[model samples]
Target: NAGVTQTPKFRILKIGQSMTLQCTQDMNHNYMYWYRQDPGMGLKLIYYSVGAGITDKGEVPNGYNVSRSTTEDFPLRLELAAPSQTSVYFCASSWRATNEKLFFGSGTQLSVL
Candidate 1:
């Protein structure tokens, strides 16, 4: 609901494997964000885009990347999956700024072994 949809709600990845976590919103929001939450930890920002073609790194971007080719799509890419990268990933979108209320996807649970 809320226009945010995340794919592959559950996934298992082998060490050194890679995948792209897809997120999309139909609300036409200009600001989209990617965040990851490790077990027992708060959500950590991974990447965000103010709009299509404008992307930027966030707090924990070292092992991840993202792209926004359209206002409705923002996908996070993990080039090399690792145990340390296993976590619940969330995608959110807002109409304006980060301080505003955001619509978040159900979440993607990823495990690396």
Candidate 2:
């Protein structure tokens, strides 16, 4: 089974363009997260969902949004993308929040000009 999958491995956008990064997992995990890593920095949580229909803002949520409509799918949306948002976005999933290892997707590299 596919642990986690992210579509559009790479994308380039104009200053104001918008796009969605799709994430899906086959492990039936209840906890999923979105993280962004800028150049020369560690991953920063952007959003997360504990379960279907339950989502919360993370450390850096501005200009980004997410929805969890099913246990296997969590999609992140970028509205009015900006150059500052250029980064490598990762989607991870785990069985539970505590003491569980996360399974991560390859990542989606986004660039805005």
Tens-place lDDT digits, model 1, residues 1-113 = 45899998999999999999999999999999999988788999999999999999999999898998999999999988989998999999999899999999999999999
Give, for candidate 1, the lowest lDDT window spanning 10 residues. Answer: 1-10
Clashes of each: 0, 0
Residues 29-99 of candidate 2 have per-residue lDDT tens digits of 99999999998999999999999999999999999989898999999999999999999999999998925
TM-score to native of every candidate shown: 0.97, 0.97
Superposed Cα RMSD, model 2: 0.8
For model 2, the stretches where C-alpha displacement exceeds 4 angstroms are none
The list of candidate 1 runs beyond 4 A from truth reads none
- lDDT of predicted model 1: 0.94
Q: What is the lDDT of residue 10 in candidate 1?
A: 98
lDDT score, candidate 2, position 44:
97
